[model samples]
Target: MSQFVLHDELWWVSEFSCESCGTRLCEHAGPGAAPDDVRQALLAAHGSVTLRPTGPAPGLVPVLRALREASGVSLPQARELAAELVRDGLAGTPAEMGLLRDALHRRGVPADVQS
Candidate 1:
């Protein structure tokens, strides 16, 4: 088995693969999986919700706390949401952040730290 690490600004995805069987442990999905559907299913199953943290230090702590209080979402779900926000640029701009926060609130999230 061969192992590899894939890192981004906010994620560290670990992958394992067997060169012989071509089996791998990764989030690296094929094109047919459709990122949107994969994301949505992940969100629903994990109870993940993304939000922009308040103030200059945008962080995932507050967003995770809020979701925990609001829906008792698991840490993994919160983690997935945090990852998505970081990837989707939801935390990059006011409008985009607002959209993400609003979507979370609609899904029963209690707090939105987004400005």
Candidate 2:
């Protein structure tokens, strides 16, 4: 049987591995979304999580900085992700989104996660 493991680590990093074969499929670090295939696999094995900012709007600069610190993305990339968080929100594995939600909250950005 083939089995996969997913790890959501620091810096918004995620690692994927095969348990049966000891194969490492991916080790991604940064704020970018995981590949569709990886997402699908995770969804199949685990579940999905959605994260959205709640309460009053937070300062853009703080949001941007939080995104940068949490995701290890550059300023411009963090800007784009902060925009997305403010606009449509973000989706990922439970652990992934949970880490982000905590990071944002620590930076004084109110956010919630649903899984």
Q: TM-scores of all models?
A: 0.29, 0.65
Per-residue lDDT tens digits for candidate 2, residues 1-115, read: 1122234333334566789999975466554455667667767778777889887655888888777766688998988887788788887677667777877887888999876
**lDDT of candidate 1 at residue 67, scale 0 to 100:** 42
Score candidate 2 by lDDT. Answer: 0.71
Error of 2 at 6 (Å): 14
**In model 2, which runs have C-alpha deviations exceeding 4 angstroms?**
1-39
Pick by TM-score: which candidate is best? Answer: 2
Give one digit per residue, the lDDT tens place, for model 1 in 1-115. 1111122111122346889999977865322222455445444544443354333323457656544443345998867766665555233222223444544564454435333
After TM-score superposition, the amount by which residue 84's alpha carbon in candidate 2 deviates from its true location, in angstroms, is 0.9
